[model samples]
Target: MESPDPSSSAPVLLNIGGKKYATTAETLTQREPGSMLAAMFSGRHTLPRHPTTGAVFVDRDGKHFRHILNWLRDGDIPVLSESEYQQLLREAEYYQLLGLADYITEKLSWKKGDGTLETELTRKDVIKCIQAQKTRFRGVNLSGLDLSKLDLSEVDFSYACIEKTNFSSANLHKAKFKLVEAACSSFEHANLHECELTGANLKEAVLDRANVQSANLQDACLTGCSFIETDLRSAHLQSANLMGADLNGANLEGANLKGAKLTGTNLQGANLQRAYLREVDLRETDLTGAKLGGANLLGTIR
Candidate 1:
């Protein structure tokens, strides 16, 4: 029960077996004279630092007090790498730390070209959102989340089950949703710039009026989805299913629609400039009012 740094302090409360204590953060061991470990609590071990080592309280190999300095600037939990940031992000999201999660997301959005956290971090954004229990979003499982006409910009949902969720009018800029199961979800009027949806299941989802700039929908299942008035500039939809989907008034400029299924899908009033449409199936798909400037429509039949 070592006291936290005076400069960085939080309310100190101790708890034993099913009991609460008025213990300070100073000396949690049994050897300390005024120690509170023996009264209500029975265990005495230090927090672990090294994976190979053990706990730190009672000589069990563990992390040192000096590591606490590493968490000097974290608002609640300090993170060192993207994986760590992602882990803490889940914790923060689960704990309903709205401001803190948003803060970390903003920090994560920094381009990795430099020494920023984003560069140092890998893509572990969307999966973290699946199990979030905080932020007034508790009890809202991905199996049935109705978020119609809501603003959910820059949120994290890494390993969640987003099946049959409705996300109309959400702002999902730079959001991470990789390796998730979002089958049959609706995302109309959403902004998903630079968002990650790799290997996601978006089957029968609706993405009308959404901006998917630089978004990654690779190997995703978007069967029967709608993309009316959507902007997919520089988006990657490689190996995705667009069967029976609608794309009226949508912009697919510089998008990779390669190996996608467009059977009976709509593309009216859409722009496909410089898009990669290799191995796309356009059988019975509507292409009316769609601009195909600089598009690679090679080896495809309407």
Candidate 2:
């Protein structure tokens, strides 16, 4: 087998996902020695050539391949729409271009091109900025927005209207929701470590599998909320309303629940080790399979 010369400036034709593309071998492998393109051009796989055009065929979306090729050519990411960015991210992940994927994720965050996080935006401004810049928002009224699977850490939404927002699988570490109205929202699998939700309205919210360690929920309304399999270690829930909340399999180790209303709450398989439950109302509550070793259950009313 004769090896192709690298110095030759011959154009290579590629047929990906039924779309034809004209490029160079150098462009395909630029800065990505371990990429899928590299593997395709490595001559290891038996790639079939076009019947008459002699173009190599690859089973991938050609529309996204153009953007990827552009990145390989100039190392500059073009401004894209939110849907386009998401599609490109999936393609980048498929090609094992982790750096590109991370870059896209960062671009989609609240950080601006100048590296400044958007910490001061109004409700209208948030929508405009998100649509124009394809970025997340902070310190704004983002009520009723679906923001699942996004990186929104370090954002401040104090006194903002955030009701019914979907934050599932989002990174909201150290975020502020003080005095915010976020009832019926979803925080499932979200990272809320050290987040402040003081006096917030979170009634009937879904927080299953979320990491709320060291978070402040003091005096907040959490009635009928879901805390299943959540990490609430060392969280401050003092005087919070937790009536009828489902906390099954939740980790509340060392958490402060003093004066909290837990009436009819479900604590099955939950960890209450070293937790403070003083003056809590536990009437009709379920503690089956719960770990209460070293927990202070004094003054708890049934």
lDDT of each: 0.60, 0.80
Query: What does candidate 1's lDDT look like per residue over 176-221, in tens digits?
Result: 7765557778787777889988766687777877888899988777
Scored by lDDT, model 2 comes in at 0.80
- Clashing pairs for model 2 are none
Per-residue lDDT of candidate 2, residues 48-161 (tens digit): 777798898778888888888777765446667767888999999998877577656754653245533333444455445544432533334566777777666777666555
Q: Which candidate comes out best when scored by lDDT? A: 2
Please identify model 1 stretches exceeding 4 Å from their true place. 1-140, 148-152
Error of 1 at 3 (Å): 54
